[model samples]
Target: MKTKITDFFKLVFPSTYSEVAVFLFFIVCYGILGSYIAIHYRIIFDNRIPWDAYFSFDNKSILMTGGSFERHPLSYYFFNWVREFSLFISGGKMDVNFRLTLAWLSNIIITLNIIQVFKYLKNIIYLPLWLSLLITLFFGVFSTNIILSFTPENFTYTLFLLSLYNYYAAIKLRKEEKIPATALSLAGITIGGLTITNFVKVFIPLIFEKDLFRSWKKFGNALFRVAITMICFIVLYLNRIDFKYQNIFSKTNQQYEKFSNVKSMPTWDMIFSFFFGGNILFPGFIMSDKHNMKGFNFKGLYMDLYSSVIPYFFIAILLILISWSYIKNFKNKWVQIIIISFLIDIVIHCVMRFGLHTSYIYGGHFVFVYPLLLGWLFFTYRTSSKMMSFLTLTVAILCTYLLVNNIFRMLEFFWFMENYYQ
Candidate 1:
């Protein structure tokens, strides 16, 4: 066992016993910066980290299963039970200020989960891992202005990251890596917990479609997957108590109606922004906006959060080159997994609502689907020129650095009131 632990670090770091050290370094850096900012900015002096939501205080109950029964969805009851007991033990609901503090902590958890989930991708190239982490932090944490914005949205999104990581772990397992079925099961559970989050997950089975017909024998394994999803679905349904979020959907959709192009973006905008956010690219959170007093505004050829960065898109282009070069050379199972998941991510977003702002230009959720595309590229490029590998790495690092810096400045403006400077 000790030997195996030693070997794991060797594989991750290759040269030295630095994998554990570097991982801890990243964690500590994240912890100290995030904790200090959250603590300094929190409204409550005694606000603690690891905050909890007070659902029981709201007396909320979910109605699930098409409203066919009087019982709240099982998920609703489960969470209610959790909330009640948790609050009871923790000394009860906190003030609004403390609640906001908790939201920041929740965002912190979400950020950490994303970093952990993508840790595997680091093995391919260290750059993408850093890039992915910063992207997750920028959009998922600092940019979302999410500390003040709490919802099942944050919880489900965090779970979605877990599910993605677990799915990748399952991939590692197939290669005989030291992973387990727990990752797969956990992935399903995370998906089942949130309706919108589940959308990213429906892509899972599609990856197995080609294998399904050939086996018909793996029916038991497939059934287990189905069973897990069912349990998760039950948990999500019961927790929300209402599977019908059409009203919420409808309200948010107003931005869609108002902002959606009369047609899908012109193929030019679609294809161009697909890779870059157009010519306006720099760093530093658009600091000018902070002093505007009216508020920061984003205006450019393409301003959607996901659509904002174009230079980091070499991975997408690399994937295209690989497909064109070796369509016939692809026999690996994981390659197929990458192909299918990438396509599904694209399809799900294009069909669903993707825009900017609240309806302003809100492609944040949709644009994130880029990672799987990069995964495909990474798999393809592993054997390519070291220069190409380095280029890909450079793009990813720059992409993340810019986004993270941008977000840091945005927070500075909001927190420092920089624009309204007296």
Candidate 2:
């Protein structure tokens, strides 16, 4: 048991002193940022009402340990149990500090994600130290990720789990080994348990594991494992609701339709602005005249096509580079896995238009793909000095722009929250 625990720690943690330093640096940075945001949130918003409904997050319920278990199966239990432990430690006076603790927890997860990106680049993708660090930093400062790091939502946890699973798959792929059924099932349970829809992503790696056409035994084994995972998830979910499963499908679909934005904006604009650009770039803030059930007026930061062409220009360049990289590394299995996983989000939010209006909040689900895909781009051009230098410079510039733009916009958001969100 001791050896197994040590091995698990070794597998999850930074292996080198430099990596550890990087991890700690981000921990402090995000910690301070999350603390600032949480303090402001506690001061600005009425905790009695779900003021965070604008972001589609139930901050009050989440902090108070009553997260929506219907949509997020295990989130309520997870937060409830954590809050119970915290209350016990603090002698039942943890209420004042619970929000801050949750913020720090999110920061820790975000920092771990950074470390995973760094390791995946340095070890599996084999990018240069400088370039890997740049891309990892780029991932850290994404507009949606910055919001998620401090927002106290399930999305941050989903981001961490998905990144961990992807990193595990990448390591296995690098070793030329198939992912074991047990590992896949565990991943399915955790990731799917968090957000039922993401269960599909856990199996995507399996598709790349073997050619199902010829590997009948492997296919059957994978199916059996998937069945087990699904059965376990269903049992847990049903048990949570006392096996009252009659209206589950209708209720879930209705909730999804309530959030859909098929008519809110033009499809092309939604695709370019919110789906692609808004995840990484800040857009103009829009506050609606209407109020929700809690009498809190909803607000959103959105990109407009006519507002400025600058965002679209950046989006076009990124798409072009990603396309170039995809074509160049089409034969690479890891690249394929990353892109396919990303496309899943595109299909769900962009094509299907589910929650397309607030797609930016969903960035945690797929934003990591940006850095990973860019890492593959760096790998593809590593042999060509000129191309490598050009790509490096371009990414550095993009990262710089993103960092400045996102930080400024974040401050703007805070100002808006303070003065207007009321």
Q: Tens digit of lDDT per residue, candidate 2, span 13-111?
A: 887886898899888888888777666655322454553444556665665654555567767667676567655654666443655676777788888
Please give the distance, in angstroms, between residue 27's alpha carbon in candidate 1 and its true position after superposition. 3.3
Looking at model 2, report the run of 10 residues with the lowest lDDT sum: 43-52
Say which candidate scores most in TM-score. Answer: 2
lDDT of 2 at 332: 90
lDDT (10s digit) by residue, model 1, range 1-422: 79967854443232323334444544454455444543344321112211111211011122112111221223344344444543554467544333344434444444444443344445432435444444333333322223212322323243435334544544454554433335455544444332343434543543444455556655555566666656665556545646564544565456447534445445334433332231112222222121112343321111323433443363345345446423633665544544554454345334443431122112222223334334445455656679456646654565565456555544654454223321
Badly placed stretches (over 4 Å) of model 1 are 1-19, 42-104, 114-118, 122-169, 176-186, 197-206, 209-211, 220-224, 231-332, 352-379, 383-386, 389-393, 400-422
Error of 2 at 341 (Å): 1.3
State the lDDT at 256 in candidate 2: 79
Off by over 4 Å in 2: 40-46, 51-54, 63-70, 85-96, 210-213, 289-306, 420-422
Find the candidate with the highest lDDT and give its number.
2
Give all TM-scores, in the order shown. 0.54, 0.91
lDDT values for all models: 0.39, 0.76
